[model samples]
Target: MLWNKKEKNKPKNISLKLYSFNEEIIFNGLLTNFPIKEELILEKTIEHFEDYDPCFFHRSVVSRWMYFEIEEYLNKIDEENKSEIKWQELPENIKKILLSDKVINRVIVEKI
Candidate 1:
């Protein structure tokens, strides 16, 4: 089945990890608190993977957050729409935050 019978009513909790040059920072919370622009990505991933009782897909979630955050920063700079922005065009501070080793590195979703 697309959805696991036992996981149908479980609460989804998300764990995020950020890795730096010398340290790793972890954040834990409900999946609802995560920022996902496309709900279909999560739903489809769950449907296709039967063993994903506790889904371990960090890159997708973090990449989404990164895109949104950068878009927000872009919007603040001007009123026109910026559908395609290049990394080199971003301001130094914005680039610094994105390039920082401390940014999110992993995401885990557990059904509890």
Candidate 2:
């Protein structure tokens, strides 16, 4: 989904680590929130977490969020079994980002 200019400009002051079920995509950032609507598939995830409090990054605005799309083909890894490996398999940078003491642990696992 194309992010709006206003949303892109927002500052996500908090740090976080995001990984897909198969560790296919890894996202690290200080995101304020996720988009409310994206191809309708994410509608529910957004609504479920809508009332969720925003972290130090700021209030959960439409902007200030970031995402990373992971393609299993790019990594040449098996996507069938993602939970087999431990968190250590993630990139060092992502690991460090998640290790930050101030990070907010607010993640919802959704099977798409």
Candidate 3:
């Protein structure tokens, strides 16, 4: 936690080529339409992100990190709550980007 503040405040840069194609036009339009907060969340949630060129895999990395973050929070709650809680009873944010059964099993198997 010593460097939590520094890590939280770290700057991220995002850049992509703007082509004259129809796909690029639609992509740029969507980016401009989204509110700033969603954009900020995408920047903050992405971890160990390195994209030298535009790629779909970067989004996958960000999504996986988001799921991992939710899983970590769930682990904390399980440690503190002591009582069992149904997954549906959890908050919406916790259910937003759920990890698959395979991934969940992997986490458990790693602990064994």
Top of the candidates by lDDT: 1
What does candidate 2's lDDT look like per residue over 17-102, in tens digits? 45554444454543333322232223323554553444333322322222222222112233343323345554543333233323
lDDT of 1 by residue, 82-107 (tens): 22334455576445434532444432
Output the lDDT of residue 68, model 1: 45
- Residues 1-112 of candidate 3 have per-residue lDDT tens digits of 1113344433222111222222222112221121223343456445355444425666555554554454455446545643233444556564444322222111110111
- Alpha-carbon lDDT, every model: 0.41, 0.34, 0.36
Candidate 2 minimal-lDDT segment of 10 residues: 66-75
Model 3 ranges off by over 4 Å: 1-54, 81-84, 99-111
Give the local distance difference test score of model 1: 0.41
Clash-forming residue pairs, model 2: 7-63, 14-30
TM-score, every prediction:
0.27, 0.25, 0.33
For model 1, the superposed segments whose C-alpha errors exceed 4 Å read 1-56, 80-93, 97-112
Q: In model 1, what is the error at residue 7, expressed in angstroms?
A: 28
lDDT of 3: 0.36
Q: Which ten residues in a row are the worst by lDDT in model 1?
A: 10-19
Q: Which one wins on TM-score?
A: 3
